[model samples]
Target: MAAALAAAAAAAAHHHRLSSSSPAARTRVVHHHHRRRRSSSLSFSAPASSHGCPRGARALRRAAAGDGGGNGSGGVSTGTVDPAAASSPSSSLEELYRSCATWTWRGMRVNYLVRGEGPPLLLVHGFGASVGHWRRNIGVLSESYTVYAIDLLGFGASDKPPGFSYTMETWAELILDFLDEVVRRPTVLVGNSVGSLACVIAAADSSRDLVRGLVLLNCSGGMNNKAIVDDWRIKLLLPLLWLIDFLLKQRRIASALFERVKDRSNLKDILLSVYGNKDAVDDELVEIIRGPADGEGALDAFVSTVTGPPGPSPIALMPAVAARSPVLVLWGDRDPFTPIDGPVGRYFSALPSELPNVTLHMLEGVGHCPHDDRPDLVHAKLLPWLDTLPSTTALTPVSSPAA
Candidate 1:
């Protein structure tokens, strides 16, 4: 009986071992199999959980892994938050300003300041200036329209890539790209001095539909015979003009040149305030301005613009632009660039005898930058014109000029 019992006990022990070692008896056999298969081959299957584990438990494990065990909800845990989502809207705007977009057409990175919400309006600054030049007008204009004041590549906090020549055509192309990509809508282009010339050129080009209307401040490209009479001092200093131009090419030198102006303190403060506020003005902005001012490429650009090949003059482009869009010529009665002393009626007469849509407004006691010098006067004329246009339709004239 004892021998039989011993044999029976041994058999029972063997059975127990077989049952425990079998694949069906192993608690994690399926998980092990899946892991091995996943390890050996490429698959996009959802991971398998340990045996007897609930779906909630598996999710908790994943959350813990992702969140490092600190509040493991897994829906954008605070510990693993995205930096972009964390940034404020104002911070994003600052980022945009610091890193202006570049258009390949002209190897210039145009710096633009965008503000407010409404129809689009593009503000272009004069020679040797940047977007900061429109500091006074941006805030007010933003109330009525989405305002975009841009630094024409070489002038502002933009990249002055070497070997690139700054011409009206190149600058106009950059403006066109900014209008199409950045603004993403038709725009009312308002330009001052040389900027006005660029606006006329851009508006004249029929291919671009973004430029819907134009507001020319101290409109250039017209007869400036009065500039000769009023700027007698400039003519007297003509011999030193090239040297002055060369010196102004450097930011530091340009700053010093302004020191000789009658109102040096006010002018310097204004320039510094615009280019760089006391807090922001640093070596970087100085370096950016210096590159275009002192470099050979910038010098070539300046020389070309100041005394370069003339395209169809402003008078020529005016008719074409007027045919496409209503033109509003806003002149500063005291404009130093294009004085109002000349026979103004005769100048207008030289162009199409009559532009039924074109209107001229003379702002009193303003200078070259009427938008800056007289924002109220500019607003007075601008708001009414904008009001006349349909809410959904941009004011683009349909007529085309004969070549």
Candidate 2:
């Protein structure tokens, strides 16, 4: 894996804008891409595939789930719903919530579902998403490892309390708390987009050994567009960013904008912008993103996230993560938000060359959400890494520390 990643990083570095002039500079660029931003934008809508998809929710039911080291897969999306966009997946998720349990943190409810058997693996979703977003992958992942997927605060069924900061740090702290109170052991954290950032922070947490491994899919450059360099990228986005921020301050404008974003047609268009594979942007997927927006604090969550801090950059956090867990990075080659050849993607693709323990895969033709877009492809790459890890059975359980 190291050799493959080193070669991949070397290849990515050669084609990337931040390619190293010297051998040593190669390692430094992984750290640099996190600091600098270039161009990024939502693309126009692409047509969805008409091919039939197997019922993921149904398949989940067939899989054996529980953490007794059994060979099976399963999980539930333990949370409430806003009732706007209902589907089989949503019904199953709500059932999971009914069957499992929830956590109350600082007066906010966090819903989570766990299944299968092996080392614990927690799944966190990106912005405007929830545990339901992971419907395709969780059951399969549970087969080999115990899987825990949660609706982060302010998203999904989780409470979005008024006056909450909703910053990256806030989310990261939430992950840490979940680890301490729920998992009660060092677990592998798999995150996509902003969820990856929170996991990065959780892995770096020194208060307790919370995370033992990481899987980042299309990890975000920062929490917002402001992460871009002051050059062309920033210049182009500044005006729009300012306009959006200005409008969000007013409830009426914010509601109007939110409505547009929530539109099913616009939702498909938004997915096409970052999803390399148009076929993955199906009715179910759109509904997953849509339902949460109807949840009570969804609008507030969006406003705070857009205006909040970008959070700790990989440059600030990667080194520490590198020092601890072996990292697996899977990037969608077609992701507009962080293209494989783009500056941010360059940093990520070049990661393995600098940090030998980290392995990077640029999933061809995949987009921002590879796990959801092409779960089979993701599983093929992910399973081998899981095979290489030490047995979770040999490890002693770490008790949750006092808060």
Candidate 3:
């Protein structure tokens, strides 16, 4: 049985490479820029597939509070709707709050939000984060793109079914499935931390070319990645991880540990530790990370994901993905979880030098979640790069239904 499983995994990896191979020469560029912006050295070449995509340049007004409503069958609007526009920040929040909807995925309730209208851009949050974590960026991004943010199953308001073994690959599959069943179109996937790695896997292994482009923010290493690292610290850390894994299997112990971890104060401290801009760790952010912990199966999901076998590593998947779609990597230099100086960060820092289809940007003073930690700086870089993408196809606005 073990041998059969290994063979299947090997076959899938080989298929991923074969499916993603393209004859076009890849273009590579790397920029290590800061928030305030300074002149930086650059070397660049155009991607093999660069072409004009018909899209309006005018900024879209945020959908008025009472103007939009979802049908609840994926809550996607088909026809063009010019809902009244509001310019205030409060209205932006109102539009976002009113846009909430839920989708049933594999007998599980998955919470999601869709806003604005244009080509689809899916925003995936990191571990323990949900749709609300993208609160600061989604409204602004939705102006130019139809933004879709989902609470991955087991996180946020999504159903967290107990005893369901969680793996990075499982989340990746969920992402691809969401693209197929919910979005129903190719999309540019923007993900942070482990979410970024999931997007990488989805883009690499997708059978239908569902992913158009990838924007990764400080992508993380797999949970079991320590097994492959040659460093002495990893050698020591592996045993500790294994010990924790064993302890977490005890329901009582897992529940107790989870309780401490999810405490409001503890969550805030954890957030502050990783956020480069400490001020970004506000009460709302803390609540966003804390709200779902009370769910019935949250503890099981947390334990399972923490102890699960490492799925495909981004380093192994990026080559296949870059061959088929352009990749934009944004790393937060101040991140502690996947420290910029760590093996994973170093690998991404150097990836663009080898793969022409990959572009790397190191965001100085930014922590793990660059999108939330410093949305302004993130937008400054992200918006321009998005305009230059070769794969843009317009889709009708999918107005979010009233909450």
Against the true structure, whose lDDT is highest?
3
Q: After best superposition, candidate 3 residue 324: deviation in angstroms?
A: 0.5
* Tens-digit lDDT string for candidate 2 (224-267): 65564433655665765666566555555455556556778867
Report how far off residue 221 is in candidate 2 (Å).
1.3
Candidate 3, residue 102: how far the Cα is off, in Å: 1.6
How much does candidate 3 score in TM-score? 0.75
User: What TM-scores do the predictions have?
Assistant: 0.56, 0.74, 0.75
On the 0 to 100 scale, the lDDT of residue 333 in model 2 is: 76
- The residue pairs found clashing in candidate 2 are 66-116, 72-143, 73-143, 276-367
Candidate 3, residue 134: Cα displacement in angstroms equals 0.3
Q: lDDT for every model?
A: 0.49, 0.63, 0.66
Query: Candidate 1's residue-wise lDDT over 1-403, tens digit each?
Result: 1111112222333333332332311111111111101011112122211112211233433432342321111111122323232111112223335433333323234456666667778888876556655654665555556777777765655555443445666667667666655565778899987788788888886385777788777665521221232245446544444444454344443333222321334333333433211322333333333433543334334433443333435766776788888666666665544556643323543333367556666655555566555454555565655555545454244322111
Name the runs in model 1 displaced over 4 angstroms: 1-107, 222-304, 343-353, 392-403
In candidate 2, stretches whose alpha carbon ends up further than 4 angstroms from where it belongs are 1-100, 393-403
- List, residue by residue over 139-236, the lDDT tens digit for candidate 3: 67776677888889889877787667777777787787777666766899999887898899889878776898999988888744442365455566
TM-score of 1: 0.56
Instruction: List the lowest-lDDT window of 10 residues for candidate 1.
Output: 29-38
Instruction: Evaluate model 1: give its lDDT.
Output: 0.49
Give the C-alpha miss distance for residue 285 in model 1, angstroms: 15
